[model samples]
Target chain A: MSSEIDIKYVADLARLDLSAEQAEKLQQELGRVVEYIAELGEVDVTGVEPTAHAAQLTNVWRQDEAKSSFPREVMLANAPGIVHGDLIKVPRVLPSEEE
Target chain B: MDLKKSTIHALSRNLKDGVFSSEELCREYLKNIDNRDSEIGAFLEIDRENMLNAAKAADIRRQNGQALGDFDGIPIAVKDNICVRGERCSCASKLLEPVKSPYDATAVELLKKQGFIPFGRLNMDEFAMGSSCENSAFKQTKNPLDTSRVPGGSSGGSAACIAADFAPAALGSDTGGSIRQPAAFCGVVGVKPTYGRVSRYGLVAFASSLDQIGPLCNDAEDAGIILDAISGFDPHDSTTLPDPAGGYADAARKGAASGSLTGLKFGLPKEYFSGGLSDAVAKVMDETIAKIKALGGEIVEVSLPHTKYAVAVYYIIATAEASANLARFDGIRYGSRQEANGLVDTYYKSRGAGFGDEVKRRILLGTYVLSSGYYDAYYLRAQRVRTLISRDFEEAFKQCDLLLTPVTPQVAFKFNEKSDSLQMYLSDIFTIALNLSGHCGISIPAGIDEATKMPVAAQLMAPALGEKVMLEAAAAFMK
Candidate 1:
């Protein structure tokens, strides 16, 4: 197994950015950690079930009726930017036409 | 009364008997925080007026014969990650420095229903990702016992505050030994309840599967009181056990008061004793086991063959879950945002600027494991190994009532002693397996290390939803 990760790609997928220095630093550190955890390869897990989480229940349901919830304004209060008084605002997804 | 030496049980009785008004208790805690907190750095934020008002309201309610209950008016400081409605829930990260929870977590709501005031925001590692509080984006919380050393984290502030008597009890969430390790380092009691035992409605998710909110306090009975207030079935959290709750208080009291473990079998996992513990911790463990034997308990050696893999399994699973959970912190929503030309750039910039080094490292690792081709190799393999690890505990419990081990390999060390991330992660070996296996565990102070002179604690764990037996044995061990 190669510890040489395309950290830049992983970082991009995780919605993160790294400077040249940070990327180099993380490349080595991530290498060390990944190598350390490679010990798991030694454990033979044939026919063992995988657990996504500790939850044993399949799905939770409630009455399909509406109930009182936190006010929309309150929910949006923490939004970094808001467009309409109630809507969360964000940077545009597409590039400029000129570009 | 020396407020610093008081316990929750004693404080509750005093509040009832009017030995000190709830207002006076709050004042004492504030004074302690004002005087001692500069050195300890345990608290991140306090709504002073709100705390005082709550204390006064409790006093007025008592005067009107409407006192909430035994824990009413008693203040419980909160971990920053668990939301408290109007208070900032930073998770001690720069990214979340400005976010406030919109509502109380179910555990906080239950505590409030019991009249326990959510007093202040306690510090923790950035998103509860590190073993040392140094990863906190805000401040480094030191061990109150030895200023030169650390309060083990990511629940470092919770443990430090309790140890310093800044708060009688505190609520902390444990994913990978966050609560138990710190409680052990600070020489107080910490409980990590079985997964899903407490509702996770508003807890800032770390590793959703492994995280469970529990208490940090002076003793087993107090831990029980806090647990009783917090643990229950919740309609919102489907994972919660559908069993009836409450009665934890008496479980602990009966354990301590009975002073007899006559028929109980205490298992000592042979793996926990080998190769890792310092002499101080080893001595403390020996003494703790001797005391358990003296209390008429039978000792059995148990094998958890996969113990060696707990840290690896935990890192993969925990980081993967964390990667998914923390992805919610993209700059478009709550928390600190660094805007860029495009939405994706904004997310990258905000996260890059907001998260600390350790948190980023984990997100990257998590992303790698869960990435396309590697997913089956790392994440799936880890989950499969997690099943094996959980089975090890299930098998061990069939042989004994509960298992005992050291909380950490050694006592608290100086800040930066564990600068290496892998070493820090490895230190959680003893306590991490508990979270992985869905069992409940507690760390009770066994003794102070003669060498480090820092506190050493013994960990007692029970199989899933086994708080009663574990707390009982913990109570027995404490006595």
Candidate 2:
């Protein structure tokens, strides 16, 4: 029902950093897309069972047994960030209580 | 020796007759790529040693009487979105530019099992996001037919690659007409199977529910060859249809041999032809319909009242799924990373730097729709409209076996022609509804449009799991 997009808040949720200029440009662009899609409101969807996918999805079952997997070295070879031997390392999650 | 003037059926016969070894065929294709691909810009990487080695092995198998099948020595170009072990599956985005897949996609694996060589990572829209191939971060792929125009996208390079004869056939994924539109633009055959017909085990997810991998080839029978090899259920993909996959190749051949459409009823959806179709494409459609009628086909009129809402509904669902699927490409993963001081900043900075402008826009819109206070209106409402869209198809199919429509509203347009994002989104209006309904559809060349003098094409749609009939109809027309 709303056409305005809060680019900053949405970008935060999306984990994407955007500058003021980019956000302003996106404001106008996304606003138009939002307006266009707003036409879907014209359709009466009451009592309509939402079709998530066209085909019915059933759970694929398998035996509870371990299978041979890719080697740790092969898996670790592609890690882009810092890795401690076989593990990938990330920046500190918690911050120091410095003023 | 000419790759452009060839087909899989002809080349397979030649290979079996000892006209040339698989290695020689491989070299001819490689030679063509080397000489012509620089201008076409279809391939992201060629892997000369790997392709040649595989081609030689196929030759050795044939010589030793251990050949896998008639298609033993043929090669297929792969869209970068489909994983090929030890090859870069970049999806033409900088984020995953350096990452090499540790496994082959289910479709690629099926191709490999039949002694078919999979080579070259074809270009595409970043994460299969754009309508024009221009969104690719690495390089722009031009229409092989017209250097100034786009080849269509998400699967642009997949279509252009086959059109230019860089490969005998190529694998392309269609999430909202990526494969079919580009195939139409490049003047070739492209198909999107019923949603559950092909396994998606290793395809990089774009919009999981909407995505289906299909083949781009010179003719309909070649599409059947690839489809026969790659389809059926796979445990790796839970959504795969539980059915046996084969007989497609023979069906196509039989259709072509019969050369008649006497008993078949084709639907002309009145909504599909009403708006936005270029005059040239409309003229081609008129001629195509006349040809079909001449060939003993029965044409009937049907109405899909919800056709106008397909584009709007598709973007909501597709973007919502993409926003979730692409979240795993954080700094710590196997792709490019832009590390910052803190963990949150790292996530923000890495994603911002890695994604292109179009990708960022989709992510933002997706996040907004799924955000608090908007889920029911945008995401949920769109899904309900999707049901209406499917119901429209369901009602139309009751009157006819297959639907004939224009694949695109216009022929391939010049690069940067649709600068506005919404305008680009509208380009796939006729094609997107089929994906939402989870039906099988194909685009086959009609003729050169008088306006652009570039290739224009027609689309044929069959019921869900109705590929046998659909490919037959396409093959009948191509004959």
Candidate 3:
């Protein structure tokens, strides 16, 4: 019912560096898109069951088996930046709350 | 032996008859890429040595009287997202620029086995995200038909290369009309086969359920030939269907002979013809339906009332999948990593710098949808809408053998016209419904829109695993 959205909050969530100009522009566009989406609320879906896939497939899977993987050297050779023992180094992170 | 302007079907016939050697055909297309790729920006990488070597082997097989599969010598350009051993399979993104495929995608293996020489990897939108090829990190591919405009993307390079006569046929993955939309924009034939009809083992995943690898070629018959070579059940791809009917070329040939749409029903979804469709496109669609009717077919109006929600539903599902799929691309695994004080910074910096803006947008959107507190409301609800969209098609197919619609609302828009990303996303509206339904579809250049002189595509969609029927209809239309 309300057409208000926090432009800066959404942009921050998206990791986009929106300038004042872009934020204003996006505010309008995003509002329209969201409004259009909200229109789906008008459809009465009381009795309908949610469908996850279009095709009727269940437990479609391949058996787990040992298969050859690319050689460690070849695999690491394609890495953008690699270090000792075929390991690729990157920035470390703080543990999450669950961790 | 030059494959310029030659279809895969024609080249296969010539090769079988010994009209030219495989090596000769491979060399000519390689030379064409060398001569024109600078301006056209088609190929991301050309494997000259391996291609010629493969072509030579095909020649030796011919000399030894060893039977080879159809199109033994014809060369094909593969979209960079599909893997080729030791070739840079970048997916047109800087994040994956330094990576080379350790193994071949199953489709590439099948293509090699069939005696078709590998052309090279063509450009695409970064991570196959954009509608126009402009998003490719390497370079923008100019439309071969009209150099000033974009070749439709994220398969723009594939379509442009074929249109420019660089490669007779090409492989492209469609998720939200990546293959068909570009094909229409560039005036080529592109098919998005039924899900599981072709294996997706080596294709860089964008949206797993929606992504399907298919052919982009100069004509529908050539597309069928390429599909025949690449499609089959693969143990590596759990989604692939186990069936002998994957031989689309033979099915198409047989279908053309005996199959007629004489009594078949076709639905033209009312929503597809509504607002935002250009007059030029509308006129061409009318003419195409007239042609189909002239061929003793019937057309009927149908309702896909959920059509307007397709773009939104597609973005939600596809981006959510993309968010999950692209998590594998973190710098630690195989891509460019930036150093930060800690792991969180590493992820933030690596992805922020490595990924393009559009990709970041989708990733963020996806992350939001799948995040805690929002999952049930956004992700769950979108799934239900997706079901409704698919059900609409299922109900419609009960009446119509195929559904016809415009591939895009308009012809190829100029690079400047789509500055707003939402506008660009709207281009996939016509194609996304087919993807959501998990059905087989193709876009054949119906005719040029008389108003703007740009090409318009007639989309043909059939039930799941109905590539044979779709191709049959397309070939019939071509004839």
Candidate 4:
């Protein structure tokens, strides 16, 4: 079973802020899922390479030429905040001390 | 003319023969949606005026003797996860409630190239996380066949629309049986082409390696037509294979016309027919096998030994990819946003509020599995086992042209029937392996479950890019 601290750590890594209640609830639920998935340990996978993709695809490259993209106005249409009629504005990135 | 019951090919023939204009067909479908959609809740958004205008354009083109193709005027529903320009591409989540797509997905673009109208955005499980459409932050899409039960999901609304006759056909993405399971439940034909057979450029990412876009239609021939229209290599999606020859529709037609499966060999995996299958579904399977034998197809017992481990590997790999793919929705770029004192807090609050319980649980599981120290034991191990599971298919196909199995252990359950997450995950046991192996699979309605009277379906899985033979067999089975 996942401890509360473990669940908190996972939530933090996922960038999800869970309340005490949510974390506690998730701990139990995730514990069950993990336990069920633990059955994979029984399979002996000696020297077998992992299959990351269903279809084998190597490096795919496209021409590095400028082409049409979504217009500036259209691209930023869904932005929560916009500045200077183009730039997407977000909250401060750096800490107060860095600023 | 019962437009709802008619197939896309039949409707196209009617349009060509001047039985009715494309505008008339659109109005009939619109009226059907108007009268029935409120109860079925299959559509998330429908633009009647836009649809009619497109239909009028189709009519004008026909009058000018420049019809695009057979499907020129066909109205099709698109699963919400697929982008349709200028329409709400919510994926049935509050996070994308305010977001509208700026461009059509590659599949939608292809459909438009064939003069097909993108009629409406259908609902799905938020980010395609849940087995049932109940995870939608919006309304729950009930089974059109039985309003009290679920429409099997995350492509629930896609399947529901076809079943309810709201559209002649629809497009749905399958990561872990999202298309086939719902198609089985709704008693329609659904196909999940081999991974990379269709471009995933515009599909909202959900397990990138496993995700595929395919069609849900009235029959195997319609599936062939839609697949031909939407499939081809795209520079946009690097994973897509170069366009194969365009004979899938012809293959289906030939198979249906042949009236015999004389030389076909079908494998029945003993693992699939074993325990945990409900008696009702098993009885249906026996009858289906008998029917297949009568059709002159030979049945052979084959073994996919690692079948039991599919669900475990699928959840790990799918969730791990989902955690990374979904990280892009951090509030600043698009979709619904929540403000906070700092950027970190902004991400936390927005994601926490935006994601539903099922999505949150998966993110947490994904994060836990992929985190440092546990990566080798969990994610890497699951990948290796995924390799073994895939190899199982590779070996099984050598013995037969295709394999037949039940799509789900049983028919669609009542709403909230299996609330436990593991139980819900286990329902996908048979279907997930195909996604993991990167093979194509189709689900066609086999018969009705005598006990519940819900739809029961049988699935046929083929080797990678084996769509031609698979569709032929499916068309034969349909006949």
- Which lDDT tens digits does candidate 2 get at residues B303-411? 9999999999999999999999998988676888887998899899989999999999998888888999999999999999999999999999999999999999999
Tens digits of lDDT, candidate 1, B1-479: 58774678999999999899898999999999999999999999899999999999999999898999987899889999999988889999989898888999999999999999988999999999888799999998999999999999999999999999898999999999999999999999999998889999988999999999999999999999998989988988888988777788899999889888889999999999988789999999999888888999999999999999999999999999999999998877788889789888998999999999999999999999999999988999999999998889989999999898999999998888998898889999999988888889999999988877788999989988888888887787777
Q: What DockQ does predicted model 1 obtain?
A: 0.81
Cα displacement (Å) at residue B274, model 3: 2.9
Q: After superposition, how far is residue B469 of candidate 1 from its true place, in Å?
A: 1.3
- The residue pairs found clashing in candidate 2 are none
Please name the candidate that would achieve the greatest DockQ relative to the true structure: 2
DockQ for each model:
0.81, 0.84, 0.38, 0.79
Q: Could you arrange the candidates by DockQ from highest to lowest?
A: 2, 1, 4, 3
Of all true interface contacts, what fraction is found in model 3? 0.40
- What local distance difference test score does each model get? 0.91, 0.91, 0.81, 0.91
lDDT tens digits by residue: candidate 3, B69-108: 7677678889999998878888988888888889989998
- What fraction of the reference structure's interface contacts does model 4 contain? 0.85
The CA lDDT at B93 in model 1 is 91
lDDT, candidate 4, B334-429, per-residue tens:
987789988999999999898888899998888889998889989999999999999999999999999999999988988989889989999999
